[model samples]
Target: MQQPEPLIPLAVPPDWQDAGSAILGGDGVRRVLVLGAPDAGKSSFCRLVLQQASRRGRPASLLDVDLGQKQLGPPACVTLGLADAAGGVPGLCALSFQGSLEPLAAWPRLIPGTARLAAAAPPGLLLVNTSGLLKGAGRRLKAAKIAALRPDLLVAIGADAALEAVLADHPHIPVRRLARPAQAVRKGGNRRRRLRAEAFAAYFAPAPAWPIDLAGLRMEQAGVTPWPAPRQLVALLDGAGHDLALALVEAPDEPHRLRLRAPRVESPVAGLRWGGLWLDPGWNAHEIPRPPRA
Candidate 1:
């Protein structure tokens, strides 16, 4: 007996097509969640999938929920438009709850709305982009919530150990780990440079924001202090119904920490960065300390 061929070399969606390849190839509608750490290329992967779907004469839409950072926009800071990429299909209809004032307080009302919008959309493939969280029990809880949504497929990008671990714990959902294009680039001088440059360009380009609820939330340029200490921040986030990115944190005697917490998960403080600076909310100075890894 011969073994079956693996589903490698997945098809890419085409340009100017309606319905994504996933839907076309499936017996029913397909819904996917693209999970990854910050800068893990989840959005890019989604675009590739949409492009492949387009190529196959199928239409798909992305439901952006990375509200803390508006990576996707109609007037995209980057070249790709989520809607245009889907052949003008409506994409990403909600905001992420991160950075919003009282996101936890507002999530109950907001998530249902997002679900309703997703449910109302035409049958096809629906892709969701998620945020990266630090390590902790909080991150685990967030992953569990997302899994509860029952995405037909889940794709985890970069070093998202926590997300992958949580999804794997479920045992019923299908998951895939995608490689970064830069990592796939053939090693050498010119090609490597070009690949790195392209990746950088894509990284800097503004994308759509994660759909989150911010009804009672307020944005403050200054970092949180006194009330939400680093540990408290972690706990608050662990308890929060919405996702939270530990943008910057400042402690009087401790090394400044930049923490990113997903809806219910808490990630490590050391890995987070903004523009090469170890994002220390505690460090108010314009200049940030460089990590030893950098």
Candidate 2:
């Protein structure tokens, strides 16, 4: 009998051990979506998650779908070393945008691409990084389309109002927010920067909630709000150790309503906004009440 060709051994990255360990601890989540606004730290968050997985010895594939920035690949613009390290895994594959919306605008085409890439992924996990589009109706539509793919986890980075809005409509999905790393950079010296980084890291290590006085807020659509001064409310929520998700507002005499899992709370703050409130990651798509049939 002819000798069979030897199977080539793949080179595992140095950090693969750590990455694998983290993957084993999670609930066998195979697919994830990294979402947020531009510069909202989506890319960095992706790196951190993948790096952790790689360090634990878990091999996961990454797909970069941020067509607007094309942040994942080279001509040596963005640092894609994380993707490179991930590629070393035996069954991993990473795909980057060619820097255009035309490719992503066609949803029918993108779905097959995601499926094909996922098929080749290792049994561990697959992470997809999406663009951070905060404004415009088109951007919102695009985000909604992407969310329909139904990844196991959805991570939104930075001030991602749009994703928060979308999540209000699809509440059952699991979504997490990651803070930006650059916020750790110090102006004066390296020592300061390191200190700042450590401080910021500590702040994010344990997720916190911030409380807001939502009195007097108005709802424009079902489960959607248009608070003229949202920053103050956001700060209050942050202060309460809660990460701000989407804000739900209700104007007096407005028939539009929000269907939150919990009952409404009466706020002491005068002009407080909102109808029903739920913490981020607390509610999912299934929790959202369905609209009445005509």
Candidate 3:
């Protein structure tokens, strides 16, 4: 028998034009949900949509829900960015800290946090980019968000059978199925970890240590977890309980005082929320226990 040639992945996704037309077809599209497995070209599709929207002179925003590999902002966060009409560079307007990179472990906060950020986005076409987690609880997490956010359009990349269950639950939402990009290459576990570490390091590259007085500030954990401790990640929240920025807790500089290494936070830090995971000096996240309640 003659041998057939091996298939090679192309550098560009074949369905880009089709996907673009399906997503940006009409002016009625307010919210779009992009779902797919890892390396399925979801982010690339988002960039394409943003560029098209800018060219069309329509205001657009992106709500990124990918905690592990973010397209808009830092890792372990759900961020909202407004597309610059002139420059095409999205600017971070708001963010909510989920703290865990694993979607399965962070779904409890992910669903609600996504909705909150989406709601806070400016009036325009809102494109939501999700993490590449389409199995088991990850699939369920996407379905729950679909129910919660009630997006106007659902963009599903790849032909995973698991997506059927997710799409089946929401028949009213229009779905645009696109083939997985030929150039998509799966990332290994170690590479993912390394990428996360690199993201964290870059986020805190110019961080300066700030000594905060913990006398009257509210400090609490997201769920059942330990109180704010050294080397753990913490969210600096405003009076409205919105995350201003991420900070690393450091050993107390003085009695009843807390120190943090974080970016410059212009907003006044009214509260402190203990993030779900901890990071070492290298910014690699370490999972903590979610102990049973009493």
Global lDDT of each candidate: 0.41, 0.41, 0.79
lDDT of 3 at 278: 79
Query: Residue-wise lDDT of candidate 3 within 80-195, one digit each (tens)?
Result: 88887752547877778887877777777888888888888889889999887777777778878888788888998898887777888789889888888767778798987887
- Residue 107, candidate 1: alpha-carbon lDDT: 46
Put down candidate 2 lDDT per residue, 242-293, tens digits, no spaces.
2122232222222322222211233322222221112222111111233577
* Model 3 clashing residue pairs (backbone): none
Global lDDT of model 2 = 0.41
Q: What is the lDDT, from 0 to 100, of the residue 231 in candidate 1?
A: 22
Residue 261's lDDT in candidate 2? 21
Candidate ranking under lDDT, highest first, comes to 3, 1, 2
Count backbone clashes in candidate 1: 52
